[model samples]
Target: MHISDQEILAMMAIPQQREEAFKLLVDKFSQRLYWHLRKMVVIHEDADDLLQNTFVKIWNNLDKFRGDSSLFTWLYRIATNEALNHLNKKRTELLNSFDDLENVMSGRLDEDPLFSGDEIQKRLQKAILSLPDKQRLVFNMKYFDNLKYEEMADILNTSVGALKASYFHAVKKIEALIDNELF
Candidate 1:
């Protein structure tokens, strides 16, 4: 069945239809969600885990969805939170320093078989890793995903102005880092 978000919501209300509707929802969004998480986490395994966690959260909490935002927005918000939380836990477990966090992520990116980008792309990824987690999130959403500031603000629960500032700073930092490495 060609299921829209509204149709899914309607199906979710009926007990028997809920599972089928949720399955369709997963089929529809799993790829987009996977790529978004992949960009944030870099490692395929970590991204897969986070994507599963995001879907599990969605399945468990689907009833609580109030339609305050688009279903896609809600899903992205959940996925973003999962990625950030996973990174935070990893950061705390590995090292007490942000510099260490950068090295860890960069190292993972290097070792990832899926990362087939050229040298400049790899360096840009490393530069992105150097940003604070929040700024990195903003940069990924804005630059890689090409999401608008207003949409990002909704996902990140920040003002558009704040997201813009974060994006601006992230761009500047990434540019400087890449330039320094080149010279």
Candidate 2:
């Protein structure tokens, strides 16, 4: 049985149905959210850990969800924040430059057993890893997840025009990287 976001929110509002509602939410969104995190973090274990953290934040802040955005947008916002926070924290812990961090992430991708992409796919991912974090998020959301620019604007709290620009640049950069590597 598919429950609408409104129905989930209504269930969450009732004390008796809250646990069941939360469970339904996890069941519905977990895989989507996990892939979103995995794209950003590049390692399965880190993405899993961050997914757990995202849900924990969601559970704690359920009541704070004002319906200003759709439940999908709100959930994505929370998950995106968690992924960005995890990446930022990891970057700081490494005490290296972003370029160095990108190298490390590329190395992790090389070693990640969970990653089963072919040579071209690995090359594409390596190009993605070279992007600035926000640009990477924009590219992943648009290119991989197939999210609309408006939805990305809502989730990232940015303008649709800005997202379009970021995505354009990300694509250009990726294309350049791939072309350079191939030739």
Candidate 3:
């Protein structure tokens, strides 16, 4: 069953109803957020950590939430930021070379039992990994999650035109990578 945004907002407004409201929110959005993080981080454990962090942030900040954007978009913005921050931290700590970084992420993907994709999907994932962070985010949100450009723009705080260009470049780069067997 779907809860209306108005219902959620009403529930959140009362001190007594806040916990249940947040619980409903978590139940509704957690899996979507998890997959989004997993696609970017390529490791289930790391995704779990990022998901927890995202929820904690949400819980702490819900009272400050304005109704300017849909709750889904607001939640997505938080999740996206948490994932990006985690990735940036890992990159700084683990950097040796670009190829080395690719190998590490590829190894994680290969080791993930949760990943059931065949050869081509794996190759596509590797190609995706080779993209810059923003481009990879744009590609995943557009291609995998099927988010609308306006929705993505609200979450990414980027213009729709910029997101379109990013996705286009990301697709072209992935095609080239696949053709050359770079991943």
Candidate 4:
């Protein structure tokens, strides 16, 4: 969203005074951040948890947030770390197919409502979740999030070239997976 680091710094300057900036921050980038976490964890409840944790960490450590990167980048980095940690802690995995997910997601979707998709989304998500962690992260950030490689590089703490390569490999993997099933 291009919120400057200075703006974030100003908001983060006082721990007690950070509440005033809530609307500004939420107005700026909640949905994108939520989905960014969702694409990692694949459940509405988990996404919500991770999103809350990401913001909480940001709020708590905003003063520690260096302005060397853009505010969005900093938020993204936090989001990524929080999501990854949650996944690691839960050691939880998404169900492998439609039947289980459909039943489980019925109630969950009603509660949190991340996305509404028919068949295409299910297949797309299956393809995405099938990817290895780094590839999935690279693909989600580059493809779905439409983030620039340089910015993603900073958020992922990887070189831009490597992020580009990872994205390329991810696309190839998804294409091959889809093709093998359909074509």
TM-scores, one per candidate: 0.95, 0.97, 0.94, 0.80
The whole-model C-alpha lDDT of candidate 1 against the native structure comes to 0.91
Q: In candidate 3, which residue ranges exceed 4 Å CA deviation?
A: 96-100
Clashes of each: 0, 0, 0, 0
Task: State how far residue 156 of model 3 sits from its true place (Å).
Answer: 0.6
- Report the C-alpha lDDT of model 2 over 1-183, residue by residue, as the tens digit: 898888999999999999999999999999999999999998989889989999998999999999999998988888899889888888888885555679899998998888898989999999999999999999999999999998999999999999999999999999999999997
Model 1 lDDT-worst window of ten: 93-102
Cα lDDT tens digits for candidate 1, 1-183:
567899999999999999999899999999999989988888999999999999999999999999999999999999999999998898888775656777988998888889989989999999998899899999998898899988998999999999989999999998899888896
User: Which residue pairs in candidate 3 have backbone atoms (N, alpha carbon, C) closer than 3 angstroms, thus clashing?
Assistant: none
lDDT for position 122 in model 1: 97
Candidate with top lDDT is: 2
Q: lDDT for every model?
A: 0.91, 0.92, 0.91, 0.75
Best by TM-score: 2
- Tell me how far the alpha carbon of residue 114 in candidate 4 is from the true structure, in angstroms, after superposition: 5.4
Residue pairs with clashing backbones, model 1: none
TM-score for predicted model 2 compared with the true structure: 0.97
lDDT of candidate 2 at residue 122, scale 0 to 100: 97
